[model samples]
Target chain A: MKTVLSIGVVLGAFYLLWMAAVPVMNIKWEVSQAQRAGVEVWLPESGIRAAGNWQLLSENLHLAAGTYAQEKPRLPSPVQVFAELWETTVEKKITSKRSLIFHAQVTLSATLLGFAMGTALGVVLAVGIVHLRVLDASVMPWAIASQTIPILAIAPMIIVVMNSVGITGLVPKAIISAYLSFFPVVVGMVKGLRSPDAMQMDLLRTYSASAGQVFWKLRLPAALPFLFPSLKVGIAAALVGAIVGELPTGAVAGLGARLLAGSYYGQTIQIWSALFGAAIVAACLVGLIGFAQTVVLRRMGMAR
Target chain B: MRANLNASKSASWAKDLNMIQPVIEANRLNLTFQTNDGPVHALKDVDLEIEKGDFVSFIGPSGCGKTTFLRVMADLEKPTSGTITVNGVSPEEARKSRAYGYVFQAAGLYPWRTIGGNIRLPLEIMGLSKSEQAERVARVLDLVELSGFEKKFPWQLSGGMQQRASIARALAFDADILLMDEPFGALDEIVRDRLNEQLLDLWARTGKTIGFVTHSIPEAVYLSTKIVVMSPRPGRITDIIESPLPKDRPLDIRDTPEFIAVAHRVREGLRAGHGDEV
Candidate 1:
């Protein structure tokens, strides 16, 4: 209920701002026309004049409606974006090219694939760094340095290179997502794997447990709390990577494609709806991961 | 030469009595930790022998290397110089054979695991059958008086109960020796006293050689058959006092003349070690 109230307030604020912008632009255009015609216009009691009468209230209302309902608006109103979302998702078939769900499905497939690849890679790298001194000394620094290279700059290079190697479409995009997602996992898992204190480690040593046994029984289980939070971050990064991956490719079948298409045609409503759609998808993914974390940790008796 | 002769004699004596061998023996043991601040002599020329079924306690102040000595016996630390054996084998070998169970100062139970799961951890690692693991877990939990807490997580239990669960974990595999480093040091006086009595009962029933480290004079006196008093600054043994108290000690026995006398001796030993440092 609180969330709903806050969202309502934010939407109302945006609507008021939108209503205000329309008249400001309209008056500026009208004043410029009057100056060009060499007519000395009197300042009306209210802001705007239309057809020589100070129809301020009616004209403002008309301008507001026009701004909100425009087929191609400079800044689409909330109702316009919401209507676009409703049309794309509810009016169209799921498999239709015009469907927001179709675009979302395309993006989600790559995000999930990338997330899985990233998680596996991160966990493997973490284990290597933890167990092997050479990897700790060599690979960890490189893993950290890899993240400093901005994904946006690297995504095109990766996509182009993979295209040259005859790997295009989903694989290139998924690879970008994987690249973005893995770093948090590596950092989180490494810290988690080493979370057991000196006494706990010594207790395991006293048992003469093998390294494998120790990993499975102590280190891995201990890393769970750390791992789940990282997975949430990783999945979000994966979605961002996937969307960004689509931007450079000019791909015509994802949310990123919809954004590009909307921008090219000046369809502000379509772009805004696509942005909201991506946010909702990312939120659902993270929420799903969080729910899984609670269940798993509870079963392990780590959660209250 | 004298140590060699004593070892041979004990071996023969052990055979004659059909008893378990000496649980731990250390001779001229020295452990120097090389830190950024230079070498800290954690232990120096420490000599000790612990036989099967003996309840031995190492009593000393902080930095006196009592815990270090216990760690050495558990193969958690390597001595810089000299030799230490656990159950007639090198510490590492003995550790590999699962000859001893070790309890740390804290309960050290994995918070993620249920009480039963924590107790069964070693059994699972040792690849015991599921039924056997459950049986041992149940038996050890019963021994530690935590029978119904099998499904409860470590955080749900009180501090003293958590410590008992840890002890139960150690006992699950039935190792012949138990090495504990200040396991009850964190508890309140009443809880510590109760645990001390329960521990003695556990010792009597199990017949395991126990090595305990503690800073408390009364605890050292009450729980141990032999108290090894130690001093810091090179970390050497000052005195070894064998308690004259009976094995079957109630909590009220802490007030007895014999217990008081032993406690007094331990206090003096600590004071004398301080005097030497000064």
Candidate 2:
């Protein structure tokens, strides 16, 4: 109930802001239309006739309706965006090219595949960093520096290079997601692998346990708590990476394509709906990771 | 002062019978840690011998290197000079052979594992059969009086119980020697006393050579057959006291005249070491 109320409050504030902007947008649109049409208007000042004032008010009302329902609005109204979302999602068949579900499926696949690859790379790098001094000194700084490069700046280059190498479609997008997701896993895993105190390490040493045995039995389990949270972050990063990967490719099958198409056609409502669709997909993915974290940690007896 | 109980007979038996061997031997063992502040002498010229089935306790204040000495025997720390042997072999070889079980200051039970699972950790590493692992886990859990609590996670148990579970883990492999570093230091007096009594009984039953490190005088006196008193700052042995108290001592035996006498000697030795500091 509280969440609902909070959401309602946010929506209420957005509606009020939209209502305020409507008149301003209307007047601006009218001025631009007049300028484009080269229309000159003369206004009578200090009018005492009630009929004239009523006529002005009616014209303003007509202008507000036209602003709110513009075919190519600069800022789409909430109701218009919602209607577009419903029409794209529920009105179309799941397999239809026009369906948001079909587009979401394309993005989700890339996100999941990239997330898996990224998680694997991160955990391996983390283990290496923790166990091997050379990697710890050399690779960790590079892994950190990789994240500083914005994904948008590199995504197109990556797509183009991969295309030259005969790699196209899903693989390039997944590569981008993996690139974004792997860093957190490496950072989290390294910390988790080293979480054991000196005494605990000594205890294992006393047992003469092999390094492999130590990793599997002690370090690995200790790293689980740290790994799950990183995975959540990685999955979210993977989603952003996947969408960004879609943007520069001129791809026509994913949510990114839908956004590009909306922008090209000045379909503000379509763009807003596509943005909302991506957000919802990311939330679901993160929620799934959180659920898995609870289950896995509980099985390990780390959680109640 | 050494009591030298039947030393002539034991010496003769060791020579003639060739059945008795020292479980641990340290000869002029020195370990200096190189730090940013310069070399810190953690252990200095430490010479000691622990015979088979001997319950020897190293008593000293903080930074006395008692724990370091135990770690050296466990091969967890390397000596800078001289040599130490466990089970008549180098510490490293002995460690590889799994000749001794070590209980650290903390319980060191993995929070992710249940008590039973924790105990089975060593057995699993040793590549024991699953059945054997389960059997040994049961036996050690029984020895530690934590039999019914096998399924409980370490966090679910009390502090004393967690320590007991750790002891069970150490005992799961049935090693001939046990090295404990202040395993009961964090417990209350009552729990410490109870654990002391239980440990003594466990020692008697297994006849394992035990090296215990502690700061408490009574704890050293009560649990050990031989007590080595140590001083800090270039940690070295100041005195070795052989307890006259019988092996079959009860908790109330702490109040007996012989127990009190031994405790008094331990206190005097500690004071002597402190006097040397001044």
Candidate 3:
């Protein structure tokens, strides 16, 4: 209940700030002389000529209401963005290209595919790194160094190279996502698999347990607490990687394409709505992983 | 079924043969650890023999090589010189044959597993069938007086209960030899006394050869048929005292004159060790 109340307080504060900032930030729509003739222009470009003009403006015009209700302003208020979101989602059919849900579906398919691929690749690499000395010594430094090169610079190169080989669609984006997501799993899992102390190792040795038994019974279960948190971070990174991959594809689909289209057509409202949609998707994905974490940890008797 | 009968017959024949041979024997064992401060002798010229069903306690101050000697017997550490054998074979071979069960200072129960699951760990690794594993787990939990706690996790139990569960884990495989490193050292005096009594009861019922390590004089004298007193600095045994206490004794035995006499000797041996260093 307290959490809900806190969230409400935060949203209300932001709304009030947005209302005050419209006039204070001087973000009124620029009126051509012809448009100015029909509508009363408060705070005209020429400075206020009289104290009576302030009264006239306050009585006849509401700059805050007008700024928020504009067809296009420098910054669209939260109301306009939400209204656009409602229209794109409910008023338009989901099959329509203009619908936000259609674009979200395009982006979500890639995100889910990329996330699964990334998680698999990460876990496999981690297991190899933990078990094989050669992989630990050789691959770990390279994994760290891979992250140093910016993802944006490499996204285009990966797409171009893959296109040359005729592997054009979702696979390319997923590879990029996998590349971004695998490092955390490797680092976290290496530490997790090694979490067993010398005494625990010695206990297993006394049992004369085989290597496979030791891994399945000890190292794997010990690594689980470490794995879940890394997965959460990896999924978020995978989503970002998927969206960035969309930017260079020049495709007229997905939230990335919506963002690009919004910029090209100067639709500030569209850009904001798309950004909110992507955020909502990321939150839901992370929340799903969190739900899984609780159930698994509880079954393991490790939950707090 | 006929082969099984013959197998038991041969096992009893092996036991008859083993009657004369000590279960664990050490000859001039020396282990020197190479550390940043140069070589530190963790054990030196340690010679001992533990007969079948004998409760032997190694009591010593810190760095006295008591724990180190136990580790060497468990094959956890390799001796730099000399030799030791378990069940007439090398430690490694005996370990592979599962000749002994070991308990450490900490309970070291995997928190993720229930008490029953932790006990079943060894059985599972040894590839026992599900029924046998369940049977053994139930048996050992009964042995440790934790019969009803099969499903409780380690954190759900108190410290004393957790230690008992760990003992049950060790006993699950029914090995003939039990090696314990100060298994009750962390408990309070009251709890420690209770565990000591319970442990002695367990030993009597099971007739297992037990090697225990501790620093407490009363703990050593009250529990052991033989007490091995050790000292620091080139870590070696200073004295070995044989206790004349009866096979069946109670907690009040610690107040006996015989018990006090043995504890006095142990304390003197410890002081003599420190005196030698000075």
Winning model by TM-score: 3
- In candidate 2, which residue pairs get closer than 3 Å at backbone N, Cα or C atoms, i.e. clash? none
Name the weakest run of 10 consecutive residues (lDDT summed) in model 2 chain B: B13-22
Candidate 1 lDDT by residue in tens digits, B23-64: 688999999999999999999999998877889999999999
* Candidate 2 C-alpha lDDT tens digits along A222-299: 989999889889999998999999999999989898999989987778898999999899899989989999999898
What are the runs in model 3 whose C-alpha is more than 4 Å off? A23-62, B1-13
How many residue pairs in model 3 have overlapping backbones? 0
Question: What's model 3's overall lDDT?
Answer: 0.88
Could you tell me the interface RMSD of model 2? 0.8
A261: Cα error in model 2, Å: 1.2
- DockQ of candidate 2 is 0.72
Superior by lDDT: candidate 1 or candidate 3: 1
TM-score of chain B of 3: 0.96
**Across residues B1-278, which tens digit of lDDT does each residue of candidate 2 receive?**
14476787677776653245678889999999999999888899999988888999999888888989999999998999998988888999999999989998889899999999999999999999999999999999999999899999999999999999999999999899999999999999999989999999999999988999999999999998999998888888989998898999899988999999999998888888788658
Candidate 3 CAPRI assessment class: high
Return the lDDT, model 3, position A267: 91
Better of 1 and 3 by DockQ: 3
Interface RMSD of each: 0.9, 0.8, 0.6
Fraction of reference contacts reproduced per prediction? Answer: 0.92, 0.86, 0.75
Candidate 1: true contacts recovered, fraction = 0.92
- Score residue B237 of candidate 1 by CA lDDT: 97
- The true-versus-predicted C-alpha distance at residue A81 of model 2, in Å, is 1.9
| Candidate 3, A11-91: lDDT as tens digits | 899999976655433233432321466765554445444334334335435444555666656678788899999999999
